[model samples]
Target: MPRRVAIIATGQTKHTARRLDVNIRELITEAVTRALQDADLTMRDIDAVLLGNMEPFEGFLFPELWAVEGWGGYMKPSVKFNTGGTVGTTTAIAAYYYVASGIYDVVMAVGFEKQSEGHTQTAITTVGDPIWERSVMAGAIGNFAVMATTYMHESGVTEEQAAKAAVKARRNACLNEYAHLQMPDITVEDVLRSEVLAYPVKRLDMCPQSDGAVAVIFAEESKAQRLAPRPAWIRAVATAHEQQYMGDSPKRLAEMRSLIAASRRAYQAAGITNPRKELDVAEIYEVASFAELAMYENLGFCDRGEGGKLIDMGVTELTGELPVNPSGGVMSTNPIGATALIRVAEAALQIMGKAGRRQVEGARMALATGYGGNAWTDVMILSQEKP
Candidate 1:
């Protein structure tokens, strides 16, 4: 079997709608330095650097080159991956493979994005098929709006249920110091009254495009023992992809097969059958409230189509049966490329017993996941102890 790989350290910058005060290199350096500090090591100790970014949004075609020098990746092995929103988690998983393959003892993964630097709408719209879908689909929001309509109809989820998730995320953001949108006492009624971006999905339900960076350090078990007193071990990692065309999918558009398959593999690998009963917490990507609801059902936290009810009952809140997205989640602050890594970092901190006010008491096992463009999904299970 491959050697055990674990996250010995993690760090993230405070998320904001715009980070005009700092340049790209400076932003990445901040995250990298903090991660190394958390690991009690210097940049020289890192054997490899895996950068995750979707640079088209920033108009920087070669951001990795500019980022490496500032991030201290002079001579170390380095590579970049761009898998839409899945990039961050995929970068961390790639670092795991590097350590698990015995090629590197210590690896660093960094994810960042500065939407304020360029035109995100143009970048997102470019993903559509130039000949067809681009002309009809409004954008990612419209694409998801279609799915939301299907989810609400087939799953019997009311608009109010989706509103509850927005309220929950906004409330949780108040507890997260690094979160961009920290509304103290947002109510479901507030969400319902919020401006409608698309039918069924209100402005509150959509994630705010932001700028930030997150970094994580991975090490083999032996290396981790030397570096961290309580490493957050990676119990399982899986990724699955589906075709992008909306028409290619069958009925019930929100029922993502990729996420379902990935979740099952992750559960098996982590030896978790009943996630609600076994896992202590979750930090899932919530680009929209509907996505979170669908994830709840797809990840097996509840029966199919029951996720909407789960949110309305406050089952996914910080004080609920299984606290989720204690860090405020993407809906509260979405840094595109960095959002998924934030999920990973938040979950890891929970397992390490380091989460501040949002910490779940006695959290030992946690899960984080990513899902976005092209119907890609990546699931990661983390534990306080080595597997």
Candidate 2:
């Protein structure tokens, strides 16, 4: 049998459009130090390290070669990963496998991004097909705009409802100290009034290009129990990928076949029949406001085309039955490489009662998702009780 794995501690730096005070190395070190302090462990206790970053975004090559010292991987096995925005969660899941395989008892997973150092749009444009989509690509905004338009046409979801998601995320961010966009007084009207970067996708509706880092410590069952009073057990993890071509899945965002498939397998592995009620909270990779509403349906939080209704009924608010994105979600803060990992870390924190002001009251089970490249999806379930 595979060894049980759990997250004993998690840490994050304050997210912002720019972190001029620290370079990439110092930024990563800051998160690592905080994670170690949270777990009451030193570098001596870590058996290995996994780092995630969108190297192209920073024009950096071989990041792990130089980031080793900052992550305390000087004499330990270490590796790096890059999968667009899913890099962070991919790294975390890899670390989980490392410990569960019994090759390492303890591991540190870190994800960081310094978007201010490079041209984010230029880096994102490279994600498209070189010959076909690259020449006409408008980066993430245009892609999401097209997806949002298709969703609106098919599901009857209106701009006002999408703006509600923006409002909820920013308001929720106000409670999270490490979150980037904390708009306590934001309203749907404000979102609609925000400048339109792309049709149907306004400024407030998109996640900010943030400079931040997050770190989480994982350990085997015995080590986990000794490391923390309440370790968030890793119940299940699943990942699904589709063809890279945008036209391959015309209704990609609206239907999100990858997310549906990943969530189905993950929920099954965790023995969850009814996600809306079985899961206490959710931390999703909602890159855009409309994407959140669309994910509500794709993740089986509600029936198809009922996502707007769910949001209208306050079903995803902080005090709702199954609160989603209580950490303000990607719509509030997105460090690209670290965005997905923050979802897992936030879920673990909720289970550990360490989410501070954004904690879901009495949360025992939670779901985290990582979405990237319009082609990949990762789903994970974490709980207070062992699975």
User: Using TM-score as the measure, which candidate wins?
Assistant: 2
Model 1: colliding residue pairs: none
lDDT, model 2, position 302:
94
Best model number under lDDT: 2
lDDT by residue for model 2 (124-145), tens? 8888888888898758999878
TM-score of each: 0.97, 0.99
Model 2 RMSD to the real structure? 0.8
For candidate 1, the lDDT comes to: 0.86
TM-score of model number 2 = 0.99
Task: Give the clash count for each candidate.
Answer: 0, 0
Question: Which whole-number lDDT from 0 to 100 does residue 166 have in model 2?
Answer: 94
Residues 1-387, model 1: lDDT tens digits: 878988889878888988888998898888888898898899888999998889889988877787777666788898888989888899988998999999999999899999899888778888888888888774678878878888888788888888888878888988888898888888888888999887988899899989999899999999898888888999999999877776854233358888888989999998998999999999998788888888898888899889888987878889899998988899998878888888999998998888899999999999999887748899999998779
